[model samples]
Target chain A: MKRRISLFGALREADARGYIEVDVPAHSTIAELREAVQHYAREHAPAISPGLIQRSAFASGDEILHNHRSVPEQGELAILPPVSGG
Target chain B: MTEIYTAVVDIAHGPLRPAEALEFVADPRFGGIATFIGRVRQHNLGRVVTGISYDLFDALALRTFQHIGERARQEVGGPMKLYIAHAKGDLRIGDFAVVVAAATPHRDEAFRACRLAIEAVKHEAPIWKQEHYIDGHSAWSEGCSLCEEHRAEEQRAAGLAATQAGDAHGHEH
Candidate 1:
């Protein structure tokens, strides 16, 4: 399945739209999605690191998803890097 | 009679208005009001910061603010009003990035609630800050250690759970 993940913070520098789209296996869990994204980053986005992707959290709508949770089939989700708001 | 205000939370794209926050928290019956404004500074980590751009997960950020307000009110144990807002886009040095206001019947509760509100926003909100430097370079600010702390705590908990399960299943050499 193809998923578009919105990016923020330092991750925004990876792409002009502040987001990236990657293909994942059907019914992929967040942990699997993280691996896919890390692979994508390595090949395409030098600014982002696999370690950062490992630490980043995925959010579906307003709720943050745990690693074991499955990615939804519809709509876009966000990839939240460690926050720095004041 | 005007309806009593409990909490007002927003993620604004334009400039944040401190005056509006003050006005929202104002009440004749309340004896004290406290406000905290966080502004973009010119210097950070010994580097000159020309400006900053703030990003947010809007829905989650607003929900976090409301939870902070409710928690503050519960902990302070008083009639309280809160106003919280954070900027969402590019801002120059000296521009306000966030504002928190609280009003309570007593000075102590007002102060405590205001402090709690701001601190919670700083730690819990899903917002990010990217600072632009004078050398035509930019970097995201090093965020608070809360995320790392949370991860550490989770690891500890998982370790404990695994140990307990091992104990139940009999130790393996």
Candidate 2:
């Protein structure tokens, strides 16, 4: 399954469209999604480090998802990097 | 008709108005009002910062701001009004990036609420800032260290859990 994930902060620099598409198995958990995203980054976004992806949290709408939680079947989710806003 | 105001939170795409925040928090019943403004400075870590771009997850950011306001009000425990606004998009040096204001019956509560709101917004809000330098390069500013701390804590807990499971398995064998 293909999921479109919104990118923010430094992750935005990775793709000009400000988002990325990752291929994951259906009903993949957040941990699996993160691995797919990391794989995509490694191949396409060399500037973004695996550590950064590892530290980032995934969000569906306004809620942050735990690693154990499954990704929603529909809708684009966001990848939140370590926040710096004051 | 008189207006009842408790909290005003927004992810502003344009410049943030501190005056508007002051107006929102203004009330005859409140004796003190505290305001905090965060601006983009010219230099950071010995590098000259020309500008900054702020990216935000609008829905989550606003939700977090509301949570911060409610928490501040409860923590301070008084009739209070709070205002929080954070900039979204490009900003030059000296531009306001965030504004937080709190009004309370007493000075201490007002100050405390204001401080609490700003701190929460800095650490909790789903917002990111990329600092553009004079050398035509830009990098995301490292804002909250809490994320790293939380990650470390999670790793530690997982390690402990794995070790405990290993011990149990060894005993069973």
Candidate 3:
């Protein structure tokens, strides 16, 4: 399936750095998704707060996936890198 | 008294205004508004500050911040309103970095609460400040600023770095 992966600020180079349009099979677990994010992050740029690749995996802990307000996919989730305040 | 809460962090094409923040909790009962807005400065230690690299350890950091607010509220008054936001990522010179606002009935309590909140924030929160100095030097803030040994070590490192660069330049010449 196709899903958008966004990395703001310094990580915006993914478009040219060969990190975009990465494929993920359906029913990928949260851990698998997080690994995909880290893979893309490393490919695009140096990893910052790699731990957040795990912490931000599901967006929030309230509900398995839906409770997350940041990156919400019906049953899917995102593992975003550590981002700064606006 | 009404209880109000507004807490989050963001980056912007603009800056943060303390007065605008206070409006979030403004009400008839709020007779006082005290705030702190931290602006990016031009200097730090020895090197000039060019910008900052902000990285927040949110789970523990925000949890601890909420706890401090709860504690201060107990000491000051119940149902007091607060709005605190920390800027993340790169903040250029003159950009806003930190903001804190506290509201209460009497001015005395409001001022006291504001003072305590800012002080508590610096020491308690896990917010780390990494400075990118203007002289091609960038590093995290060293703890224990009052230590003479630490200062001496810093001096030595700067001296060595300068000497190494100077020698390389002389060799090329």
Candidate 4:
């Protein structure tokens, strides 16, 4: 299945792309998805720091997901860094 | 005599209005209403900041606002109304960046809910701020860490100066 990973903040800076489509096995966990995203960033966007990827949070819809959590195959996977809104 | 819990969450491109936020939580039965408006300051840390640009993940941000409202209601243990509006895109100094309001039958809960809502919005919402400095540099700010760092540095410098002055007085004695 192809998962559309949406980047935000520093993650977007790392990806150098708004989003990227990656193929993963069914029922892929967020940990696996994050690794895939990192790999994509490493390959595509060299300017993105490893520190940024390490700090990023993965979310499905509005809920921030733990690495162990199962990511829904549907919908965009948001890359959320430390939020600074007032 | 109003809804048990009324929530209004918006991620807008234009300026957020405090009046609209206040109106959302207005109810005849509520005895107290508390509202907080966050404006873009002309300076941050030691840097002269001209403006800021807010970027938000709208769908997720709204979801976070709703969750915050629910959490506030549960914690307050009362009927309440919550209104939150956040601005996106470019904002000049003194522009309203965000507005949070809470209305309840009592002052305590109203204050608690309002505080919680704004804090949660700052920590939880998927919004990023890029501060434009007068030095012609712009960078993303994380929880205003840059400002915090500057403050810390100033405090450290002041402490060192005070210690040095005390040492000079001791020598004179």
Best by DockQ: 2
**Which prediction has the highest lDDT against the true structure?**
2
Scored against the true structure, residue B172 in model 4 reaches a CA lDDT of: 14
Per-residue alpha-carbon lDDT of model 4 for B89-147, expressed as tens digits? 78889988888889999999999999988877876688888899998999887541112
All candidates: CA RMSD in angstroms? 8.2, 8.6, 11.9, 8.8
What is the per-residue lDDT of model 1 for residues B27-88, given as tens digits with 9 covering 90 to 100? 88788998999999999878899998888878777777877888997978868888888888
Please provide, for model 3 over A42-64, each residue's C-alpha lDDT reduced to its tens digit, 9 standing for 90 to 100: 77545444543443423331222
Q: Model 3's CAPRI class? A: incorrect
Best by TM-score: 2
The residue ranges of model 4 lying beyond 4 angstroms of the native Cα positions read: A15-17, B1-13, B143-173
TM-score of each: 0.82, 0.84, 0.54, 0.81
Ranked by DockQ from best down, the candidates are 2, 1, 4, 3
Candidate 2 structure quality by residue, lDDT tens digits, B22-91: 8988989899999999999998889999998888888878778887888987888768888888888888
Model 1 residue pairs with clashes: none
lDDT of each: 0.77, 0.79, 0.55, 0.73
**Model 4: residue B108 alpha-carbon error in angstroms:** 1.2
Which candidate model has the greater TM-score, 3 or 4?
4
Cα error, candidate 1, residue B2 (Å): 11
Error of 2 at B165 (Å): 37
